[model samples]
Target: MSAYKNLVPRFLRYVKVNTRSDEFSDTIPSSPREVAFLKDLAKELTQIGLSEVNYNPENGYVTALLPSNTTAVVPTIGFIAHVDTADFNAEGVNPQIHENYDGTSVIKLDPAGKYVLDPAEFPNLKNYQGHTLITTDGTTLLGADDKAGVAEIITAMEYLINHPDILHGDIKVGFGPDEEIGTGADHFDVQAFNADFAYTVDGGPLGQLEFETFNAAGAHVVIAGKNVHTSAAKGVMINAIQLGIDFQNALPQDQTPETTSGREGFYHLMRFEGTVEQTTLDYIIRDFKRDGLETRKAIMQQVADDLNHQYQNRIQLTLKDQYYNMVDIIKEHMSVVEIAEAAMQALNITPDETPVRGGTDGSKLSFMGLPTPNLFAGGENMHGRYEYVSTDTMEKATDVILKISELNVQQH
Candidate 1:
């Protein structure tokens, strides 16, 4: 477990590859640049002694299998991480490496934004006072989101290969592109992955094990109205801009992201732009319970119906289901969660089992019949320049991966 001495360098090199996923792209990986990065990763996996390492440049997915050292038969578990950085700027990612911190004000050079980790703004700084904190230089984001997770998982696998005496079972490694924009699992070959249960090592902070995520759907609302001269507008004109505002007001404010947390779902307004003649409002609806999720969709429809009744069917609502809660699939095989829980406990980290307010590749993987859960990558403030990860937590996350491999055999 102590072989993480050179892990940071490997991870930093990977992040510098510019594997950011783009939502605007039609390709599965979203970016062809990710394929070049996957090639290097495949080479590293082979260098570290992972078996069956395969690099598919066309779709940009890298997979490798770590053979079991001990004769103990355990459930073949998979570890997954994403390679792409978020759509945020990756130019000049001057990652600040604070070897040992005194919990003082860590500043970005020429800091201009209101996005710093000040004690006054973030009281959580007190927690990592004495440890190492790696942050972006207030310019580009440090790709600690899932890159940290990918590095930790691979680092842990290397440790297992280096130490044969530490009994463990077979482990599979999966690294995909385009997770940031939600297409990481779109082209994944789960049957080829060949793991009964898996975990996405892509959660925030440490000891965070999530098997439940939001049942998500994107709602697009459109309104049609007639434009007329202002003097004659009273009788001939219909205003879609006002109708759009009314539609937003119709939803409960308390059910939004700012007011909701945990299993409590919310309606996230992704975009709201309109005009007097035509308006468009895009929203993302999320909830854990299937019935509650359906109820929310019904409420949205009801609002649209009422508006249409008033405006002579002028408003149209269209929804597309993004993803579903993976709980139903993951719960059927509860031992996978227990396996991760016991593994983290074995490594002396108190596991915090929480529902993800957001979705992950794990959400899609579980529905794909892999029954994947998520593990922490020891990061906070993801997808922004304020992103950072603790060296201690990253190392522990690696240990958790190793211990999970060991615990799988103990269960056998």
Candidate 2:
């Protein structure tokens, strides 16, 4: 907020911690590294003069409170971000800094030029021509997905602690682990993180403000087959792997992650493991509406039903809902969205009210009685090696946090 005074340094420091989460791990934080980093962050919050700073090991969240300086009644707002990176290589993340980018030059991410960040492919690079850009060195991911959010939140809170004259009501800050694997907020203690409403500083690009996210569900399909000797396998054997492929073909091929955009829904085949005796297919279904998600789920069920009738009940399908669109809960509390939009406008930032294609912790938190909207953290091309964040945009994001805190009290 103070013109990148602490934002860039904090971000650079946090991204190097190697807090990548594991989807296969059954632990609460998913990774032991995340637990250690979260404990360190809890200590840092306490050292920064924040009140009630505590790390709950049960939920793996470090929560703190910036107590109000004013006696006037105002709603207690919260800000949340995650500490874990996505399912990518995050070891020894050496960030590259490009100052005053010329807007047209190609960015070689490695000495061998194996990975390059070019304006022709990523035209958003042109938008931050004169701003500082932080990117990965092509050896690993930059972890800016939420580290940028974590840094911005802490910097804005630090600024408020330094300048108490800018009075406001109580502000809550929460940082959690394992968000990348989609289970971080599953055990989140929303009651303990008490706030009237919250905002997730976990969006991409500049001016991104989102309250809508995909209505998500995960499906697991297993097919059983009779394995017979090839010498006598003439009508006695059923190949489960072939049946799995048939099931996949039955789904709409045109509707997929690469082929869809905006509000369009998709059935993503994430993992497929098979053998002649048995095969398993793991899929994630995403849609913006609940009915659309249900329709997709029904399609999977019908595929299983038809296949089971043919194979004598050799197929098993399990479907589970992951999260819902936060807009369904946020629309009733439009003030939360209006305050963020007003804050961005006050800082001369255009409010991009685009819907997120994926889910955030807010997607679950909003349903847990906290209506949260998402604000940008200035990162682009998240979850991969080409990921980058604009320091100028991060400073603006921090300023938006401060402005939102200030305006919440002024308007209330």
Candidate 3:
């Protein structure tokens, strides 16, 4: 079957499995539903004639191998995609298919007209004119973020198996869980994957080829205050909620996710909850440079330290490093990047080398010695309602995978 013909159904099937990951869970896969879906995917890989189909229960990764068909010892290539969806409502995802989308119409997502996908709000919708777009029902995310990548990888592998004339070296494919929570690749066995270089097909939009990502850290701040009755609030009441506001004001007001873009660093406050007695602030610090990330972390600590000094040590701050920029590792292996660029050129797709403002599995995998970069999977507005993927773009992504394999063999 053609790649486009196989892509839609395969993608639809994968997204409906409800593999949404949890950030708070302590399990290996974060959620049991992820394990169940991955187990089934493992069986499917074996049935598709892949070899060494092993599902590692310890890390919730399913890896399969397609043996080399040529005698020339070419470097092995690996394609990876995460099986888990973002922390969005992914239950009973009823995907809506818009065949031959008109460029300008406001497509209503629900029967009640409460949600709509308008070209005005998302100008990129015009690019998919006359193409098939897969979207959610406005109640949940479409989960196309990485599912499109998973489908494309599997479909491309099946194509290579069917076409024996396309000689290539051994190709490895891995699908892991809990990527949405940023811990899926923490336990990734790079030695077992055994690829000289790899690509995580988890980027947004078509033609996006990224290697640089934010150096990240998470910060937790707690403020403790003495609560008193309103009538006796003269000098005895130290409101923790007010202290929380003061702490936030100490950070760079202009440096935040909303005000920053491309190569800029920011302090993103992800969560805040508390009462008069105690307030906690959860923040994610991001920078493209390691030194910049450290500076951002230090700023948070300085803020807390200053507050604690004035309030008799009523504030506590904790910071933890999350991931680093993949470019630091991928730069040394520019040949791998050149290969992807050439593949896109051959397919007449313009290569967009935009630096990712956020990190991916590739960020951690590169540090793990995989030297992985990220490729596009045709998803747009990921991780929430109104997320969509173009079937035409997905077909192109599948073709890119095949082309990359062919080009690698030719180069070797």
lDDT of each: 0.85, 0.93, 0.93
Distance (Å) between predicted and true CA of 208, model 3?
0.4
- lDDT comparing candidate 2 with the true structure: 0.93
lDDT tens digits by residue: candidate 3, 99-184: 99988899889989899999999999999988989989999999988999999999999899999899889999999998888899
**Model 3 spans with C-alpha error above 4 angstroms:** 1-4
- What TM-score against the true fold does each predicted structure earn? 0.93, 0.98, 0.98
* Index of the highest-lDDT prediction: 2
Better of 1 and 2 by TM-score: 2
Residues 1-412 of candidate 2 have per-residue lDDT tens digits of 3455878888999999999999999999899999999999999999889999999989999999999998889999999999999988999999999988888899999988999999999998889888879999998899889999999999999999999999889999999998888899999898999999999999998899999999999999999989999899888999999999999999999999999999999999999998999999999999999999999999999999999999899999999999999999998999999999999999889999888899999999999999989999999999899999989899989999999999988997
Superposed model 2: Cα runs more than 4 Å off: none
Model 3 residue 373 distance off true place after TM-score fit, in angstroms: 0.6
- Residue pairs that clash (backbone atoms under 3 angstroms), model 2: none
Error of 1 at 294 (Å): 0.3
Candidate 1: lDDT over CA atoms?
Answer: 0.85
